[model samples]
Target: MELTPEYYDKGEYIETDTGNKVSRKSVIHGSQNIILGGKTIIQTGTVVRGDLRRSGTAHAVVIAIGKYALLASRSVVRPPSKVYKSIFSYYPIKIGDFVHIGEGSIVEAAQIGSYVQIGKNCVIGRFAIIKDCTKILDNTVIAPNCIVPSFSVYGGSPGALIEELPECWSQVMEKNAKIYYSMFTPK
Candidate 1:
């Protein structure tokens, strides 16, 4: 079920078992799909392109974001499509826990790690490996298939290594994941 409200103060999309939610100010165009086993929330002003493939049948985005994973407003997430490929099919995008996705960024065909913060207006290349506790500052490019060494701060034009990641990154992600699991229990 897709929700298109004109304007809402604080909008929430909840699944039977919890999934993706795009806020009221956000524009989601296509078949409404909610994920399960995890929680993913799209904040205000976000635009999710669901039917970009046009493959005769309905095309939906695969994967889910772990609970407490917040996707800031204006972020773009769509089904993975190869720029050039012999066979065209959909690839899924998976986001882990305690993850903070910055505003106005483009992410596709990537497996983001837990406790990862991706800066705004940056591009996460297709098929990238983002390890845990990595802080990718704003305006950086995560190259395709590039292995981001875990527990580091990466910043600069070509993504040069900055320093060791914050000591709290690991602890924070773990806590987020645990709290998320607790939501599944019955009251």
Candidate 2:
């Protein structure tokens, strides 16, 4: 897919040495605990919560987003938290390379694999595992503790496997993600 150019005010963003572009308007808490793996774009109004952590852990990574990932405007990326053995702790969120999270989505997934595309206004439930090369359509609500398989398409409330993707899905997703990144320009 080819994305149109998205223009932004140069002063509204900061480009890191590794080519990650982060919007100043984004709310990123505990920045030291969040890692962007170069060439990622964090758009305006996005909230990345890295402040929530396991009790007694002083310096732990809460969110790790991989290279060429895109977090669209108004999206929220938060670590999933749960009570286990009477202990409540927030687990880390691992987003893989070439992933694209669409606008207004809220993600609290344990792991999101590479080359995945999550459409607008989606809710990824806590501790949900989304495998590689999958697509979650817009307005979908994934159930907690769900495991989405690789090369599948999921949609609707309590997101179910809609269909299986072709072998070329990975290549297509990768290409689209790169194009989207390249087209996000300062004007």
Candidate 3:
């Protein structure tokens, strides 16, 4: 599907040399610990918490977002944390290329594979792994430690696998992400 052009005020965003469009209103904590791959877009009010890291680890990345990924308005990307052997530590979040995290969503997933689309107001639990070419529908709540396979559609509370996607789903999702990024223009 072709996305319509969405314009933003030129003063409201910073366009990096690598084509990353980051909104000025977004709260990105610990910038040094966050890596935004070329052509990524972070929209208004998005919060990326890169400050949370494993104990005793310095100069470690907490969030890594890949190319053409879109973090929509009001979305929150936080590192997943857990207590292991009497130690509490946060883990890194790796978001692959061409992923779209929708508005108002909160993601604490350990990994999100390429060409994935996550819908609005969803809660992706800590350490959940969403594989390539998956679509998570709106308002879903994924349970912690859940493993979502590739080419699947998941929805509902405690997000269950709804159905399998077609073989061409990766291509379709990649195209969609590209279109969305291209259409996001500065006015």
Candidate 4:
């Protein structure tokens, strides 16, 4: 069920002592979970759950995002649940640090690593592991539970593993070694 952007009204702002700015128009509280819609800007330390949506499916909400991770405008993330169609679906989603999830992509039970760029309209299924520094092009379907190695470029449904990566494969970062922080760091 695709709800139009206008359905969600933007309110003042959920401000706090720190700097978490949650949009008033967004769904921060409900009968079950705190449902967020367009114009909804949830900040750090915020948690929402009501098991909203009409999927006849099970959904699980999780607290995600790194200390400095920014969930871009119009990005919808909730708990892990299977999105049956492109029309409307959100799931257990864990977006890592410095990740860029492009437009209108649907995800379920997916763990996107740091520095990962999932292009527009990606169908990342349950149990999918998008490793660090990987660039998934537009309209790709990463099947359920797929384990992608770090620094790879995937561009097809059922996914095709190739070696077309940026130059972060051989370099190293001094402080954080697990993620691809600097351009010189290897995956």
lDDT on C-alpha atoms for all candidate structures: 0.65, 0.94, 0.94, 0.52
User: How far is 157's C-alpha from truth in model 1 (Å)?
Assistant: 2.9
Model 3 whole-model lDDT (C-alpha atoms): 0.94
Worst 10 residues of 3 by lDDT: 53-62
Residue 87 CA displacement from its true place in model 2, Å: 1.6
Residue pairs with backbone atoms closer than 3 Å in model 3 (clashes): none
lDDT at residue 15 of model 1 (Cα atoms): 38
lDDT tens digits by residue: candidate 4, 81-151: 55465655554455665555555665553587766766777777776888877777888888888877787
Model 2 steric clash pairs? none
Q: Which stretches of candidate 2 lie over 4 Å from their true place?
A: none
Using all chains and alpha carbons, the TM-scores for the candidates as numbered come to 0.71, 0.97, 0.97, 0.55
Q: Between candidates 1 and 2, name the one with more favorable TM-score.
A: 2
Question: By TM-score, how accurate is candidate 1?
Answer: 0.71
Clashes of 2: 0
List the candidates ranked by lDDT, beginning with the highest.
2, 3, 1, 4
Candidate 4 whole-model C-alpha lDDT, 0 to 1:
0.52
- What C-alpha lDDT, on a 0 to 100 scale, does residue 15 get in candidate 2? 99
